[model samples]
Target: MSLRTTLRVKTPPGFRVDASALLPVRLAAMSVAEIERIVLPAGNDRCIVGDVFEVSRGEATPALEAPHAGATLVIENAAPWLDRVGARMTDGHLVVHGSTGDYSGFQMAGGVLRIEGDAGHFTACEMRGGRLTVTGHCGDFAAGALVGDMEGMTGGTLTIHGNVGARLADRMRRGLVLVGGNAGEFAASRLVAGTIGIAGQLGAHYAYGMRRGTLLLTQRPAQLPPTFTGGGRGFDVFWALLVRSLAGEIAPFSQWHAASLPTRYAGDLAVDGRGEILVVS
Candidate 1:
């Protein structure tokens, strides 16, 4: 028998559904009947998985392996009302065929979470470790700290193929975020440590209060804050290493030559002042 489980939505939920409980690791142990009985929070009410989806089992793909005995889980016909699609998932693969609501991969520690469509706000908030990819646009606060939290994404890799909203990585302690399209304002506010790459234009007040981190931009912004200044050099070795490491990650950056160095600005001088912003020529 195949170790893959598929959940096809029978009907779009009229209210937002908290689908966090339906994780790959947990589902891999359940029988088809048991999976159907699983409960989910839908708005102010509750519903069982069988009420909204048709469950089936199929062959597993070689590309994805669970940390242990768990099998991969696939959600088909996913919609924006499905929230927390892979929250706290530790192992295994989870794929969403359509859009998802807020906190799509909240605190994910391991495994792969792939969203084929856009993701809502706080898409990967407080993520500790793992790989999360959103093929379409993402809303604000991705890889950022949640309200009342002191830290954002501590470790992980987040890749967005489309534009992103404001506060892209607020208070991020460590991680890698790549955006293929434009980014909104305050792209790396108060960033403590991490690497953020944006291939398109950046909005106003970007890198505001950034303390220690690297922000790679393919296009120069309209203006940079006065807190930042130029004259950074002697980092050819670091630039070459970075370019080589990112050569397979995203475009423009992936196409950069190791010998070419970009313009560097150091700042958010009002604070730690150790952060660096590299603008590709």
Candidate 2:
């Protein structure tokens, strides 16, 4: 039996609240109304509680019920530009009720973050662990490798239930990205190691400069890039496990686009590239 707490924003200019930085912070212990009483620094000034939003409380068992379960915090009509909704979160769960700004879960270490609405750019950039599940669309570089650094998302899972913008998973070294909807161009460009599964139509320049990784698409195009060679149709158990594990994490993935067996292709032949591309044959 998990407790529930709803903390509403009660301020006007919402300049001093970043609930994310206080993550692993428990709200269930506090009364529903008390949760809203919490205060923060508002840009070199102080403000009254409950001026910007409201709070509600309920219970959460295994799944977040939006009411109960200290597991979730409903961001009821929070102001835009509220970044880092779950930055560096190590444990617990977070659910966003509406659209969130950029870097929603930057560098998250562990735990689960479900965004019920759209998210701005760099949603899960450089995340090391945990799962970031988005019910709606996502901005550019949804799970891209960190800027300047070579590795991005070393562990964890990213599932976008809706369309995703450009540069998806750019230069990522590890982890997995499953796009249930269409993905913009340059998907998996310069990827080193990991898996990117795109269910809908892929944009142009797929796997650009990819050195080593796996890109799985539903379409069975006649030709691949000249740099790749067909590895023949085969059954991969790893893919089966991948789908099974992700299906529960990303519910939309329950819909299968192709058979369990798929054709595998290796390489962009541009770098030390041993990456493989699996397409539904």
Candidate 3:
């Protein structure tokens, strides 16, 4: 018998499916049949969950026990239009075996959203709390606000193991975002507060209009944005504490705790923003 609840993609979504309502917390008590009967919004029409997915019941294990009790929803295929996979989720585990469409973890509050493959745009948008990990590349506007929303991710840890598209972490309020590879243009634009660590190169116009936040880059940019001006000191203690906290997030950032101070630029004078951009010099 299966050990967890598995949903195999039978037909790719042609329109957006608001699957946020179908979460692990709500499916733990339902039988396989019941879970299959759950309804999900397909654009303007409604479609039964089973109509698009082949459901399989998993054998109960510690994974479904009290502390972790909740049907582990396992997705086997990639569907780009299947938005909001774990939006507003409170608990349980959401494991996507393959790539998924936009809004994969939109406004996700709690629990783990793991995608083995790539993810679409708005990944983890307005996330309040929890852990979201995308093994592959993610489209634009990741960890940022929705179309009209002012704030982006408010809390949680978003780790992207691959490259990210434009506007990464735009207007992010709070959270720890670590990108393993390169980030596109306008990365961390209009940032409010939080820490972002990037392992690879960054695109142009980095940290423009950043109000406040920390952007830790492994490689220095070709040229600093004109809106910022260099200089700030006496942050050794603060940098020490900050690096120690970030040690677990990435490897290179660990050495920063003891490394020489980076060349700090404070501005976004365009907006009179107090944010600082640190370049490893």
Model 3: weakest 10-residue lDDT segment is 62-71
lDDT of 2: 0.73
Q: lDDT tens string, model 1, 144-254? A: 999889899999899999999999999999989999999998899989999999999888888889999999988887787899999788999988888888878868778
Q: Give candidate 2 misplaced runs (Cα > 4 Å).
A: 10-19, 22-50, 55-58, 65-71, 221-223, 233-235, 247-259
lDDT for each residue of candidate 3 in 1-281, tens digit (9 for 90 to 100): 22367788897656777777667767767887998888898777888888888888765465433244354667788567677888888777778888878888898988888888999999999999888999999999999998888999999999999999999999999998989899999999999999888888999888988989888877878888888888999888877788778777645665565567777888788885688877764
Assess every candidate by TM-score.
0.96, 0.82, 0.90
As for lDDT, the candidate ahead, 1 or 3, is 1
TM-score of 2: 0.82
Best model number under lDDT: 1
lDDT of each: 0.90, 0.73, 0.83
Ranking the candidates on TM-score from highest down gives 1, 3, 2
- The residue pairs in collision within model 3 are 2-58, 2-59, 3-58, 3-59, 4-58, 80-101
